[model samples]
Target chain A: MRAVPRCVPCVLEIAVNTVERAVPEDRQKEAILAATERVSELYRMEPTPQPPRLGTEAQRTVMKYSEDPDPYREEKRRANERAAAVARELESDLENIEDPEELLKRAAAAAIVGNTIDFAVAGHEFDLDELREEISSAEFAVFDLKPEDLRGARVLYLCDNAGEIALDKLLIEVLVEELECDVVVAVRGGPIVNDATREDAEQVGITEICDVIDTGAEMLGLLATEVSEEFAEELSSADVVISKGQGNFESIPEEPFPDVPVYFLLRAKCEPVAEELGVEVGSNVALRWEPEDENVRRWREIVR
Target chain B: MRAVPRCVPCVLEIAVNTVERAVPEDRQKEAILAATERVSELYRMEPTPQPPRLGTEAQRTVMKYSEDPDPYREEKRRANERAAAVARELESDLENIEDPEELLKRAAAAAIVGNTIDFAVAGHEFDLDELREEISSAEFAVFDLKPEDLRGARVLYLCDNAGEIALDKLLIEVLVEELECDVVVAVRGGPIVNDATREDAEQVGITEICDVIDTGAEMLGLLATEVSEEFAEELSSADVVISKGQGNFESIPEEPFPDVPVYFLLRAKCEPVAEELGVEVGSNVALRWEPEDENVRRWREIVR
Candidate 1:
C-alpha cells in the first residue's frame, strides 16, 4: 500500500542522476561544485535569475518523500539484490536461447514473475488467474513472441520506472516468444513526472533486448505528442503496442490510431483511471484493442 | 528563504490538531488517529482535490514543503526560542510602562524586534521604512493584534502558519497599544492549503492575546468569498485591516475599500507578487492600500 510513496525516493535518486548528467560529462566535478554553490544561494534567497525555477524543481525532486533518518538504505540494498537476481536469470536464459525472439519471451516471463513476487511482498494482492484471462482475451495483441511471431508484425513495449525496467524486460521476452514482430521499447526522453528514462532502460539491458528509442514525452499516455519522426515511423509500422502505466492512458490520442491495436497495462493509481477500467484503485487492468473491432470501437467511444 | 517551506509542516501539525479538535475534546485522540489514516491515503495521491487554483494556496501553506521530514520538531524548537526571546525583551520593557496600552505597545515592539531578528537570521531582508510607510497610509486596518487593541480600532491580523502564532502575539500587542480599537485575529476554520488553524492559534497563545475567529477561507485573499457573516461584519466595521502572507493576497479581492484601508505584509515567494513589488522572489513587501487613494491606484495600474 505504501509502495508508491516509498518509490518516490528511488525516483528522486534517478532524477538526481539525470539532472547531474545534464552538465557536460567533461565538467562533472566542476558542475557538482557549482551545483552546491547554486543550491546554497538558492536556499539563501540570493539574487540569481535562474535560481527560483531550478530551486523549485530541485526542491520538488528531493523533497517528494519524507527523509527517513536511516534513508531506506536497507530497502535499496534489497532492491539491488532483486535486480541482480533478474539480471542473472536473464543471462542464463539467454545462454540457452539461440533466437532473439525466444530470448524476449523468456525475459518478459521473468519480469512478470519478479513483479508478481515483489508486489505481493509489498502487500499488493496478485490474482494470476485474472491476469491470464486478460492476456488470452487481448485482441490484436502487442507482445514479443519467442522467435515464433517475428514474421512481419511490429511491437512496442512502453516502459515504466527505473528499478521496474528489469520486470519490463521480462514482458519483452514473452512478446518475443509469442509474436514474430519487430519490437521497439519506448522510454521517456526527458522528465515530466516520475517515469522511466532511456538510461534506465539501457541500464536494465532493455536496449539489448530490442531496438530502444525515446518517446520524447513526459508520460507514456502522452507518447503520441512526444514521439519523434523516427519513433513515430516505428509506431506507425508496429502492429501492436503494449503501453504500461496510467500516464499513457491520459496522453494516448484517440482519433489518429483508430485501427491500431494497443494493450494498456497499468496498476490503476488514481480514481479517474480506475473508474475508466471499472476497477478499484491499485487494481491492474490490461485492456486490449484491435483496429476497427467492436471492443476497440467501444473503448474509443468511451474515451472520447 | 527555506523558512517559508518550514512553515508547511508546522501548519500541518496544527491541521492534524484542528481535525482532532473537530470532535469532542474527549474523542479528539481517536479522531486524530482516523484522520491520519485518511490523510495518509490522500497524501499518496494528489493530496488535495483542487488543482491549479489550489496550487498557489498549497504552496503558501507549506503543503508543498511538508514532504520534508520532521519539520514539526524543527519548528517547535525555533518557536520556543522565539517565544523566550520575546518574553525576555517584553519583561525588560515592562519596567518603562505603567499603562496597559503602553505595556501592549512595549510587547508589540518586542515581538517585531524578535521577528525581525529571526527573519534576518533566516536570511529574510526586512525594510522597516517600507512597512511603516504602508501602514501609515491605510484608511482601514485589519490586524492580528494583541488583546489590548480591542479597546481601540477593529484589527484583523491574518495568521500564516502554525507555531508562528507566538510571533503573532507581538502583532496583537501592538494593536492593543497604538489604538483603542477592536482586534480580531483570523485563522482558517477548516482544513485549508497550509494556512494556520484556530487550534494552532490557541496553542501559540493567540487565543489569549485577542479574539480569535475563523476566516473560513483557505487563503487570506479568498476571504471575501469564504469569510463567515460575523467575520465579515467585523471587517465591514473595521477601520484598518492587516493581512499576512501571499495567501491573503490571492484570496483578497482587488477592489478598493474606499472607507477601509488594507496593509498587506508578506514575503514574496512566488513570481507575480515579487513582480508587483518590483523586488526579487523572497523579498518581504509591505503594501498599504487606501481604497480610493491615487498612489494605490497608480501602483495597481502599473502592476496591471
Candidate 2:
C-alpha cells in the first residue's frame, strides 16, 4: 500500500530503534536524525514506497552515520536460540495432532508468532504467554483453500524475520511431508533489520529440509524488479506462494500476483496495512487474496 | 525538558497535522517529509534545543515547502472562538467563589485547560466535556504558594498557544484585581504552530485585561538569547513569573532560575517532559521548581 503522512513518523521511529542498538544513548538521537534527513529525500519522489522499503533505506542511512555494519547481529542470534528451544517444544506438541490441515494451520500460526521478532516492525517486547493466547484464539480470515489446492503445486515460501524462521521450518516440514508439495523457502540475500539470510537459514537447519535459496535482496523483502533472475523465475513458476509477513505483503508487486494464488499469511500490525486489508489492528490472518477472491474482485472493480 | 528520541516522531506528527490542513492529501506526506528533513539538521547542534524549537523549525520548513504561510490561521481562529465561549462558561462558574485564593486556583485550572488548544502538543481532538473534566478533576502538584507570592511584585505571564490566551486573561484578572501585581503577557512575534502572537492576544481580549507584548520570537517560546531586549528585561525583572505549557517549561534555562521562583503550570503530556519532571504522563501540574524547594534540592544533590 502507498504511504500516508502517518508513515513518515514511523520511518524515523525505525531509524531511532536501529541507531540506538549501534551507538551510545548520547549519540543515538544524532544518528537517527541524520538517517531521517536521508530517508526524507525520497518522500518527494513519485510512486511512494512501502514502510519496509523506506525502513530499509532508514537502516542503511543509520549504518552509514553510526559506522555499525551489523547492529542486530547479536540480538538476532539470541532470538534464534530462543526460537529454537520453543520450536522444539512445539514440534512435540504437533505430534499429537492427527489432522494434517490442523497441524499446518497451527504451524502457520507458529510462523506468524515468529514474525514478532522484527525489531523495526514490532518493538522489542516478546511475551510468550501472549503468543500462546494468539495461537489458541486467533482465527485465520480465509483458510478455505484446502490441502487439495496444493496437489502437485510448486510452493514458494517467503521468510521474514530471523529467529522466526526457526518456527517457519515447522510449517515448511508440514508443507513437504503432509501436503506433499515441492516447497522452496526463500530468505533474504543480505542482513537488513532482523530479516533472515543464507547464513541464518543454515544456522537454523532450514537448509537441511527443502530446497533453500536467497532472493539476493538488500532489504527486508523481495521487490519484483530488484530480485535476481533465478529468484524471479522461482516466483513466476510457483503454483501457490505463501507470503510470510508485512514486509512481503507490502513489497510484492500490486499488479502481477493475480495469476498465481498468493496466500498472504500475516498479522496486520500497523494502521496502513490494517486499513488496506480492511482489518483491525493486531489481526492474525491467513488471507487468500487471489484475483478470484471476493476482496480482490472488488479491488479490480474499484480500480477499473 | 530535553528532546528525547521519542520526541523525534512527534515532531513529524505535528508537521503532518500542520501541512495536511494546507496541502491536498496527496502532497501532505511530501510536505511533512520536506519539513522533517530541515528539522533533522538541527539535531547535530550542541546544547540540544527543546521540542518546541525543533517544532518551530518543522513548521517553518513546511511553510517553505508548501508555499503557504500561517497554515494554522483558520484553526487558530476557530480555537480562539471556542476558547472564548468556554472562557465565558467558566467565568460564570467561577463567580460564585468569594475567596481570591480559591478563585485564582480555579483560574489556574482554567488556564491549564485552555493549553490543550495547541495542535503542536495535544492531538486534534477538542471535547468540551473532557476539558471540563480536566479543569475540575485536576489538582495542583504545587498549589501551596499563595497570591502573596505575587504581592507588590511584577508578574510576567508567558503565553503559549493562541486560543489559550483567552483563559490566561482569567488568571491575569485574578492577579491584577486581587493580587494587585503589574502583569505582562508575552507572546510570539511571528506565526509558528498555534503559538500565541500579539494579534491572538488582542483577539482573545488578553490585551484588554493586562499588558500584552511580543517576545519578538518566531518560535513557540523564548530562548534567553533569542528574545528581544525588552522581553529579556521583563523576564529578568519579574518577581513571580507564571510560565504556561510545556513549551515554556522546556524553554526556560535549566540554571539561573532560583533567583526568582518560576511557577511552571502545565500538563506533563509527553514522555520526556514527564520523565524529566518525575511525574506520570497526563498529570496536570502547577509545578513550582524553586531551587530551594525540597524536591529541587534533592534533584541538585542527586544530579551532582
Candidate 3:
C-alpha cells in the first residue's frame, strides 16, 4: 500500500513511540525528525494505501540514534508473560469445547484481540480485561474456510507480535494436536517493533510444540527474497497459511500467493487497511482467499 | 508559532474532518492531498510550535474542492444554540453569586470547554451535557490574575469559535457590567472553521451586550496588519486582553505586546501544546503573562 495523508501523522506518532523507547527524552526529538523526514520520500517511492511501513522506517532510523539495540525488549518480555498467563488460564477451557470450528474462530478472535492491545503504541494503550471483553464479542466479516482445510495438511502460521504470539500458540495447539496438521510458525528475522523473533519463540515455548523458523525480513512483513531457503520451502509447501495481524496482511499480497489458501486473522487496526477492505475500524476480519475461492467476489457482487 | 512533526497526522485528520463535511466522499482524497502538500511548505514558512493553522489550511483547501463555502455553518448554528441554552440556564445562578472572582473563573473554564467539543471535528464530537459534566471537574493550572486587573479598565476579548463565544458571554458579563470595564469583543471577519464571525456575534447577541468588531485574520487569531486601523486601535488601547483559545495563543506572539497583560484562557488540546506547556492532555490552562511575569520562566528553569 502507498501513503495517504492520514499516514503521515500516524508515521510520526509511531516514530515518536519507537524513538521514545530507544533514546532518552532529549534525544527523541532528533529521531522523530529523522523519521518525519522519511515520510514524503517513502510515499513518493511506494504506492498509496500501504501498511505501517513508516513505522518500520522510523524504527530503522531510531536504531541509528538508540542506546539499546532492542528497545522493546522489556515490553516484549512483559507482554509475553502477561499474555501467556491469560492463555494458560484459558487453554483448558478452550480445549474442552466440543465443536472444533467454534474453537478455531474463538482462537482467531483471541489473536485479533491481542493485535489491538499494543503497550508500545503511543495514545493507543488499553487493558487486558478490555481485550478479553473485546475478544468475546468480536465477529469476523470473513471466516469461510473450515478446520477441514487444514486437517492433516501442512499449515504455515506466520506470527505477528511478541505478546500476541503467546495467544497464537493457543491457536497453533488446536491445529497441531486437534486437527492433526503439521504446523510451522514463522517469526521475523530480527527486532522491529514488537514483532516476534526466534528468541520470543523460545521464551513462549512455541519451539517446544512445533518447528519454528524466522523469515529474515528485518521489517514486520515476510518477503521471499529476505527469507532463508528453509523458510521459503516451508511457506511454499504449506497447504493453508494463517497470517496473524496487519503486518503479514500488508506484506504478503494475495496475487503473489494465488495458489496458496491465505487466511488473514487480524483486526483492521488502521484506516488504510480498513478502507482497502471496505470495513470499519476495529473490524474483526478473517479474510480468506485462494485462486479457486469465490466467497469474497460473490459477497462483493451481492453488495454491488 | 511553527509546525511540529506531531501536527502532520493532526492536520491530515483535520483535513479529513473538514473535507468530509464540505465535499462528496470522492473529492475528499484530492482535497486532503492538497492540504498534505501544504504541510512541508507551511512548516518551512512558519516555525515549529504553531497551533491550529492546520484548520485554516484544511478549510482553504476544502473550499478549493468543495461545493459549500462554509460547511460548518449548520454545526456552528447548532453549537451556538446548544451552548447558548446552557449559558442561559447558568446565567441567573452565576449572576446570583456574590464573589466576583469565583464567577469569572467559572466562565473562563466554560469557554475552555467550548474550545473543545467541535461538532465539525471527526473524532471529537461531544454532547452539551457531556461538556457540562467536563466543566464541573475542570481545574485551572493558572488563574492568579485578580478582578482588579479589569476594574474600570478597557478590556479586549478576542473571540475564538462561534458556539464558544456564546459561552464567552458569561465572562464578558462579569467584565462589562459587574467590573464596570469598557469591553470590546473582536471576532473573525470571514468564515473559517467555526471561528466566530460578525454574524455569529450578532446571532449570539453580542451587539445587545457590547461593541462587537471583526478582525480580518480569517484564521482564528488577531494580526494587526490583517485588520483595520479601528481594530488595531481597540487592541492597543485595551488595558487587559483575554485571548479565548489556542488559535490566539498561536497567533498573538508576546514579543509584539511587551507591555500588555495577555491572559490565555484555553485547553491545551493538542500534544504539541500540552508538551510545550508541560501540562497533561485536556489541561484547562488560564496562563497569565505581563511585561515581566517570571513564574513561567522560573518554572522552566526548575524543569531544566
Provide the TM-score, chain A, model 2.
Answer: 0.85
| DockQ by candidate, in order | 0.02, 0.51, 0.36
Report model 3's TM-score to 2 decimal places. 0.85
- Candidate 3 docks with a DockQ of 0.36
Question: How is the predicted docking of candidate 2 categorized under the CAPRI scheme?
Answer: medium
Task: For candidate 3, write residues A1-304 as lDDT tens digits.
Answer: 4555566566666666666667776665566556656655565552443545656776788778888878788888887877887778668667777888888888788877777776444444456566666766778876765888778989898998998888889889988888999999999888887789988888889999999988766675654345666776677678888888877776566223424678888888877789877888878888885644443343233222
Q: Model 1: per-residue lDDT, tens digit, B1-304?
A: 1111222222234444333223344443333333323332333332222111233342233332234322343444445454544454444445565676445444443433333334313434445444333322322222233343245666777766553456566657656654545678887765453345776676667677678888665443443444576666666667777766665554353432325666666666655456555777755455665555653453334332
lDDT of 2 at A113: 68
Deviation (Å) of B205 in candidate 3? 2.6
lDDT of 2 by residue, A83-151 (tens): 877778778767778887778788888888677555333356666666666665657655654667876
Q: Is candidate 1 or candidate 2 better by TM-score?
A: 2
Ranking by lDDT: 2, 3, 1
Docking class of 1: incorrect
Model 3 per-residue lDDT tens digits across residues B15-34: 66667678776666566666
* Model 1: CA > 4 A from native: A1-153, A178-182, A189-198, A216-220, A223-226, A290-304, B1-304
